[model samples]
Target: MNDDTVTATPAAPAAEPESMPAPEQPAATGPGTPDPADPATPGSRRLLRAGAATAAAALVGVAIGIGIIKTQYDDPAPATAAAPSTAPTPTASATPYGAKSNGSHFGSLRDLLLPVPAGYRPGPDDGVYGNDTELNGEQLSAELDAELQQIPKDKRDKLRSYWEGLHVKATGVRTYLSTGDDLVIGLKLRQFNQQEVQRINEYTAVFTGDTGLFRIGPSIPGHPEAHCYLMPAPPSAPIDYLECSAAEGDLLVIMNAEGVAPLPKDKIVALFTLQLDRLARPGASA
Candidate 1:
């Protein structure tokens, strides 16, 4: 946003009044007596006419003086001295209206995805066929259609209608493996309408909150909205699994971890934190 400065202009000074000629005075006359030669005399009437002219001139002068005084009182105040010239300090531009922390985003959704970290190579692409890790709208729609195949037709139709209302826009995915223990980390980001993205957290809580099949996982510190769930493996099973999801802006961030019975809970939380941080702070390096 830019700052606006309002400046006031000084009013011009009122013009000075022009000088007026003084009227001639009438000659002195005795009470009840008139001089024939005097213009103000009753016979000639000149003295009376001269007296009237003098009085009119005086009245005009008085009126002119009053007008000048009123004009001075109504004039605007004088302008202040100009400010000193100096280099302007730069200011950061305001964030766009539709772009906010954990509410909305305006840039490429794929750009907001967390970058592949050190010691981990790019995981298998989740897009249709051998497509890139980033999925376009059409590809995502096809994937959804495939997933809906297992459900009954009526239920699938209703779910599809609900999904359509979400207006999913894009998706990004990355999978990587640790150098040791063969631990695999899969990350998926889905961008949709903000309202639908928010509902993901609520849905995850209801479905994964207290199911006997999965144990409560570690909470993402500093991110109360994020939730994690761990599937308890059978005694003879060789691997354990964990899933975490968070609603960040218009993106639903998901992480799936599979490894030996004892998954690195700390590392999982740390990675999830990094991904969430990336979404929250668009300027930060992925």
Candidate 2:
């Protein structure tokens, strides 16, 4: 029932090799002195002189050749304009899923949540008055701080460090009741730093993987990143529940549905997909 169970699971780093000192550069040899390690003979010195003379002659010949080539271009031809390019100028690539260039939604996070369907009405208010609820960055941080008050100081410090790294921005919540089935549906969106969205998604998957009473809910068509989970009622319990979680851009989408046994999995998935589509293209969905 709480997305807070999803935490950062950082990968362990590989060990690096021990540092080694670089070998010293060889000392430069001067023209007058042959390297003492390998003294030059008289015949070798004479051969070196002849080689130097040949190199000087080659340099002179190259200079003369350059003058001849330079003279050929001395009388330049009239310049002509360049032909216009036929290819179209490139435009910036479209943003992924039609989100903003920076990968976050452009406006109110609540607006990004899926609208209530035809047969549903606003569900019971679990918060102040309305079915919708919101919390800003400071409010969220304060809430976490209140929850962490009972823990040891050292553990609190570490948890606070991880919370700071998330850069949590805001959260939005909405609920709905199906008139015919008395099913209660809840939706929540938590916005945070873009870099941590996928990490949160992975953590959610791991947290929900193969636990008792929890099974894979359903697949959200066209969205491989989104997942749904279902927890059926136990013999003593009468209500069944379905939950969906996805990382959409910088926002984490969470959905919950509760009703009698045999909860409508297709309905839950369809609702989830609609929500994702709205996020993918805000303007069109609006």
Candidate 3:
């Protein structure tokens, strides 16, 4: 599949008073003299009115700030027990979501037809596909060239190597709407026999080093003949991505799901299975 470096948090602000405390509760000097709370003195009344206005303004600012944060970071609601699903959860495991990936047999990776899930819709415009286009192509596309410039030159080679060795036979780029806009998924089918799959798995087993600006992640749950890795972006990059592949028959199917938000493990698996199911159905194009 197209290689994509995974994506990119901030510190919460301390809840201190946005405004200075009102004049440190002016000392009540001379009991008979004007007290700060005394309505009898116009200056005392003015201070009280000013304090009320400042407090009200601070409350308004806080409410607006919270509204912005929630809009930017809002996430899907947790799945509820009563909700029904054709997709069932599997026995718990050590994988990123404890998912038991589809172990069912399949004829070929080339036959699987990908489907856009419910919450996911197609991207607005045609988005160029690849892990990150610049890293995989002989010439970086205009957009990717810009994203790459964000990374330092010394780190470029390492990023290129992540997809440099992979042998891909075909690639399909599809845009989907999955709780967000322009979520791009790249599906790659590679030619790899049983022996080759074993060798590749062994190679990835000990392969640990700099991935340029990309962050390598742990293997996901179940698969037929390969492992899944959570590919994240360097702290500097703008988005996130995931890569999972396994040998199916004579072909290795690699999936690259990416967006500004990190996709859940189960959802990626769901998309994978959806493609496989499409391929399995009679007369359906993979």
Candidate 4:
């Protein structure tokens, strides 16, 4: 039984030898082989990884540098010098009656630029009232109207109509009786007229009687010639005279203030005459 078994087993084919893994060979080193510790080495995985990391770090560094450069060069700071002050300039003060108040008569017309009349005591009214007359302002105006009534009917009618149109309300009428020292002075303010205004400006006087005749040339710098005359007064007062005339535009003005005591009649007449003469001189046209 042993012989048969041995023959049949043909000697279990010689046992196949188990193959062992070839011993690991050292990696081949070419001309550019890298060392694992060196980042610049080629063909070394550790070196390639380190190099990639270093390149990435360098790119990041460049970006940070560019940002810093831009920040430093782009925007500038604002100027810090102190700002200038802003203040208003001062102006000059204006003078009184100089281009401010147009010519206004605060007192008697004559008082504005001439010597005050002698014995001319101030009246209760701001305007001068004659001290020589018993008649107050109202009575003087009435007497003036009575005197005007003596004009020719047609002329009186025309004059009355004109005065009515003017809305004239007589303010005062008084006579200054001549007291040898002064001529009688009378003044009446009824209404304003352009012609009478012009005449007044020219200093022209109009008289209604024989002794009143006189010529007054322009006394002002520029004005037209003016004429004066004496008109009859009420018989009761022979020395009293009515000086009536047309002003600027048929404006009737009558002067009847009489001069007495310290004022001469001739002097009063001459004073008025001189005043009118001044007016007759040319004045600068309005």
Candidate 5:
């Protein structure tokens, strides 16, 4: 049984062992080529180290280039930066009111002159009518309170004297205008001959420039030919004043304002001159 079992076992196929993967072969090389698997090859080692160093250098160069670009972009922009005008800007006048400049009569002396600024409405006229001597003092005084006259009494009398000899017929136009506050514009126009014109040129008056509630009048600009004075603000009286006297041919013009005019000196003068221009035009008597 043992001999038969041995024969059968021999007859049984030889036992097969587990298969193993083959070793990776080193690549074939030319006579001068270094073996990549050989760690002892100095030339191969140097080539690998050099390649790694070049790659590192390339990465460093790329980083430095990016840094340079970032620096240029991050630079800050340049950092020095002109005052803003305070004059009254009067608009053009309304049709009928503004039409005085074209040599048209405005019915009465009150209608002829500009009462307030261009945009405002004219107020009531409170004045009188007469020839020069009669119109000069009593009529004007009656119209205004005697207390309103800040000039010394004699000076006021002296002013009356200027009209004593002048031959002229005049109408006084007085009215108030609503600015931010209210104001009065007074105009006394004496229509006359060459003799009266000569009288106006010959007249002269004094201003003491006194300090008190009274401020001496300053000469209005653009009136080298006219005599003008700016008066003080009347206490609780609700007004300051300016007076201008000028005589053109056949006309003696007295322009007065009872308020601190809301205008620069030059602009006020320009406006006054414009009024005069209108009155002096032919067929447009003040």
Candidate 6:
């Protein structure tokens, strides 16, 4: 489950125009002309010749001028009348599950897609992981696990099953789990899910130091509605894990760790809450 191992679906390419030949021009005419039926007098013939020559010359001059104009201002080929630039049709931003919003502002996958959990409180660290920010994998996991342990064991197992189904694997132990309405927010939950899997694999490589196949489990208590993964760090370093979910009106997020330097419990709770707030905002889905 290394990050590099995760691949995204490719997008389509734009279309191109085909080449074609140019049109032929018409023959030029003179001012004066002689009847061919009559073997015209020399004078008349001369006049006719002169007229034809003049007409040809004039036509050439006009063609040259037109070429110049085309080169300077006009498009060479019949210009494609520009299609009216219709404004992009706006999509409805609000959904029954939540509101639409951007995920970029929030650091973690959970924050980017869902609203903060209700009755949530930070343990101690306010700015560290609590306020819309990132907590190291180890710290986040430890805090999350401690919270999830508070839930009934059966509930925890149900949550774990959900995550296991997704085959989520990281390099650490999970510490916390929480849920919110993400589908309604119009978040690119599918893309987020893919990225989460990739991130778990990446962290696994970082923790193990040596490259190897890592298997992630599914749902856990705190993230009952979402999927989870684990990747234990090397003995010398802290483990790292991540959990994410995108269900009808719910989003579940989880973090884990099992070593020194675990993320503060308060910050972990706060981070989840902030994510939910963003998801609940209007226009977030767009």
> Which candidate number would show the highest TM-score if scored against the true structure?
2
**Candidate 1 RMSD to the real structure:** 42.9
lDDT: the better of candidates 3 and 5:
3
Q: Output the TM-score of candidate 5.
A: 0.38
Which ten residues in a row are the worst by lDDT in model 6? 4-13
Count of clashes, each model: 5, 0, 15, 49, 1, 53
Q: Give the alpha carbon lDDT tens digit for every residue of 79-189 in model 1.
A: 221211222221235433224744676655445666656765444322121112556667766755765564457644644555566676776656555656246666767
| lDDT (Cα atoms) of all candidates against the true structure | 0.48, 0.50, 0.34, 0.26, 0.33, 0.26
lDDT of 5 by residue, 140-215 (tens): 3343233225334553343333334333343434333434333434454444444545343333222112213123
Query: What TM-score against the true fold does each predicted structure earn?
Result: 0.58, 0.62, 0.38, 0.30, 0.38, 0.23
Of the pair 1 and 3, which is ahead by lDDT?
1
Candidate 6 lDDT tens digits, 47-124: 112111111111111111112212222223222112112321222453234433532222334334433334321111
- Where in model 1 is the C-alpha error above 4 Å? 1-102, 125-132, 143-151, 281-286
Q: Quick one: best lDDT, which candidate?
A: 2
The segments of candidate 2 whose C-alpha lies over 4 angstroms from its true place after superposition are: 1-98, 127-130, 210-213, 235-237, 281-286
Question: If both were scored by lDDT, which would come out higher, candidate 2 or candidate 4?
Answer: 2
Q: What value does the lDDT take at residue 99 in candidate 5?
A: 30
Every candidate's CA RMSD: 42.9, 34.3, 22.3, 61.6, 51.1, 32.9
Error of 5 at 145 (Å): 22
Model 1 alpha-carbon miss at residue 179, Å: 1.9
